[model samples]
Target: MEVAYRIHLTAILSVTCFLLKQGLPFRGNDESSNSLNKGNFLELLDWYSLRNEEVWKTVNQNAPGNNQLTSPKIQKELANACAMEITRVIVDDIGDNYFSLMVDEARDASIKQQMRVVL
Candidate 1:
């Protein structure tokens, strides 16, 4: 899998598991079966998260600030790829000359995805 995608999936799984811990609805599973979805660097995230819920909270809640200080190059690369895909589909259907690519992004713990539209 792509590096950023791997990171993204890790975030998703972490959120899912976090929600599960906080009594969020999930598909269903047993801890004994060991079928949990820990996407990436599970050991490290688990260790850090266990050590500091406050830090995790800061990271989660203060994302805007963090992102401002963090390089979003990889994230933007993925977003750009998605946008190009959307643009390709629209241009195929309605030709490229008159269309514009518009992008919007949304995020929660469980999912962080970008939406693209042709206008």
Candidate 2:
């Protein structure tokens, strides 16, 4: 059971990384099972399961309902974790070295003001 759970998480993480790298949206307007398009994340997982038997068996119907790990909150947590890891790597690489920082403010597509920082 533990191994299966790990496999399931690995699959989810892989799909999450792929979507993040592509800068794609994770959720759709309608994400029900009956919905034709269940968003990029779920759709990619389905596509991934088709190519991997272990993943297919360890997720969705095969896994326990409580351990599905398919919630939106779980997805956000994974993304945040990835971002933190990236920041850690950057900091480590710049350790004890002078680095330039840049900051800017802009509005997004939704007209929401946002700040960007680079180091």
Candidate 3:
């Protein structure tokens, strides 16, 4: 992959991980379509741009006309890949080892059922 593409992908993965750690949705209602939304990946990119102009510059350099990689569909696909890679690493670390896991189920304030697994 091109360096700019790699950098962009890395930035996307980093932001996705941050969102996952915070238990926040990567895409909001306003971002359901192709348009950019403030609280989602677009905001993350803007944050990066502000935090470090050089890094954002590198990503923008290789980005075609626009940053198509920042689209919601692309972001979701990249997030899934990131999750899979993380799970694979965790599973590999547990290979040939016995580990105890606890699953807790509860309803959140919105009355949605949620399950958390602790290992």
Please provide TM-scores, in order, for all candidate models, with all chains considered together: 0.26, 0.85, 0.73
- Candidate 2 per-residue lDDT, tens place, 1-119, comes to 88998999999999999999988889988999899999999999999999998999998657988887788999999999999998899999999999999999999999988888888
> What C-alpha lDDT values do all the predictions have?
0.46, 0.91, 0.75
Q: State the lDDT at 84 in candidate 1.
A: 78
Question: How much does candidate 3 score in TM-score?
Answer: 0.73
lDDT of 1 by residue, 58-98 (tens): 44444454342122353345445555776688779886466
Worst 10 residues of 1 by lDDT: 24-33
Clashes of each: 0, 0, 0
Backbone clashes in model 2, listed as residue pairs = none
RMSD of 2: 3.0
Question: Candidate 1 clashing pairs?
Answer: none
Error of 2 at 13 (Å): 0.4
lDDT of 3: 0.75
Give a tens-digit lDDT track for model 3, residues 1-119. 47767677677778878887787877666754355675666677668867876657765554675665777787788778878998899999999899999999999999999999999
Candidate 3, position 58, lDDT: 61
